[model samples]
Target: MLVTGCAGFIGFHTARRLLTEGYQVIGYDNLNDYYDQTLKQDRLHLLTTNPSFHFVKGSLENIELLQHLFTTYKPKIVLHLAAQAGVRYSIENPHAYVQSNITGFMHLIECCQLFNVQHLLYASSSSVYGGNDKIPFCTTDRVDQPISVYAATKRSNELFAYTYSHLHHLRATGLRFFTVYGPWGRPDMALYTFANSILKDEPISLYNNGKMERDFTYIDDVVESIYRLMKKGHLQTRNTLHEIHNIGSNSPVQIEYIVQLIERELNKKAHKRYTPIQPGDVKRTYANLQTLIQAIQYQPTTSIEEGVRHFITWYKQYHNILD
Candidate 1:
């Protein structure tokens, strides 16, 4: 199995789970300075301890390198998770999104097709349901409108994956992930930023006057869902091979409530500054996980409180904070 972005938060957890299941996992990551390179390195260090894991430090944009790796590994399964992730960052650096999400993803799909990969699983975002006032975003819902470049790129990835699956008979699965958070999460994410700011008695910015809500899925649950789906792979019914599912908690929690939870966990008050919604920001995100549940029996059991507590525990340990 080949796992892209293996040093990332979701990729790391997924790779670790695959290793435990006795799969020979080959990890590919650029280790970019998007957030903190040390965090990526930490994940790589942990994975390298397992004999079944092999690490390759490179970017997906390197088409030659990607093709070489694919040819060398000849992996049966491909998990493509690497991309320029932040919605707001996409506004500042739109070209990065194009280069990585669009161009790099095209190369990856080509490699998957060339290698005759049995199944290809790639990450999409709930942000694809942008400007849709729907409560629980479903796969059947229209996702033609996207607010951010990041969302647009993810939606494009799904389209490309579908095309490849239909034309080349390659089994492809695209996972629309909601706001996933937990230990070893990206520092730029709201939960991690809020936790760090609250710990340091710094002010945390609240966008959209703190009215935004997100389906914050825990890392463990997200990884469990992926692991189960990996085993299931691409279902073969008749001819066409394609599947897409939303992996989320199916419960949207208010942003303010999440801040309050962080405060409670850290035993510190947050200094919040309410502001208007930023560009490329969505009002809310709620995932309709019925398809995932029906297909892979994926039911996220972690509540916001439990997930936050677990994250705080790890944060404290990682930062060497004495309670």
Candidate 2:
């Protein structure tokens, strides 16, 4: 099995889970300074402790490296999770998204097709819904309108995967992940940023006057969904070679409520700064997990409070905070 972005948050956890399941995982990542290179290296260090795990430091844009990976390892299953991931960042650095999510994704799928990869699971985002007024986002919903560059790139990946599946008969699955958060989460994400700000007594910005809501899926649930899909995704019979599913908690919580939870966890009050919503950000995201539940016989069960507690605990330990 080959896992890209093994140094990343979701990629790291997924790679760890796969390694624990007795799979020899060839971990690939560029270890970019997107947020913090130290965090990425720490995650890689943990994965390297596993004898079954092999590390490769390279970017998805390097087709030569990716081709070498596919040619040498001959991974039967390809999990493509490496992408420039930031909605707000995309507004400033659209070129980065185009290069990594578009060009790099093209290289990945091409290698998968050439290598005869049995199953290819890649990440998509709920942002593809694009300010949709619908209650819960579904896979069947029309996602042609993506508001942000990040969302557009994810949608493009789905289309590219579909084209490859049609042309090369490559078994492909696109996972539309919601706001996944937990221990080892990205610092750019709300949970981690909020925690950091609160701990430092800095005012945390609350966009849209804290009116936003999100379906915050836990990391463990996301990993479980991906693993189930990888193991049984081949059995899913469809007219086309491509399939897409929404992996989310199916429960949307308000931004203010999450902040309150974090404050409660740390026993610290936060200085809140109410502001307008940033560009390329959605107001709310709710995922309809009926498709995922039917396919995997499971849905995300971690509640907001529980997930927040887990993240805070990990955060304190990681930062060496004395309680």
Q: How many pairs of residues collide in each model? A: 0, 0
Cα lDDT listed for each candidate: 0.92, 0.93
Tens digit per residue, CA lDDT, model 1, 65-102: 99999888899999999999999999999999999999
On a 0 to 100 scale, what is the lDDT of residue 76 in model 1? 96
lDDT tens string, model 2, 104-191? 9999999999889999999999999998887888899989889999999999999999999899889999999999999999999999
**Model 1 lDDT, full chain set:** 0.92
- Residue pairs in collision within model 2: none
Q: List candidate 1 stretches off by more than 4 Å.
A: none
* Candidate 1's TM-score: 0.98
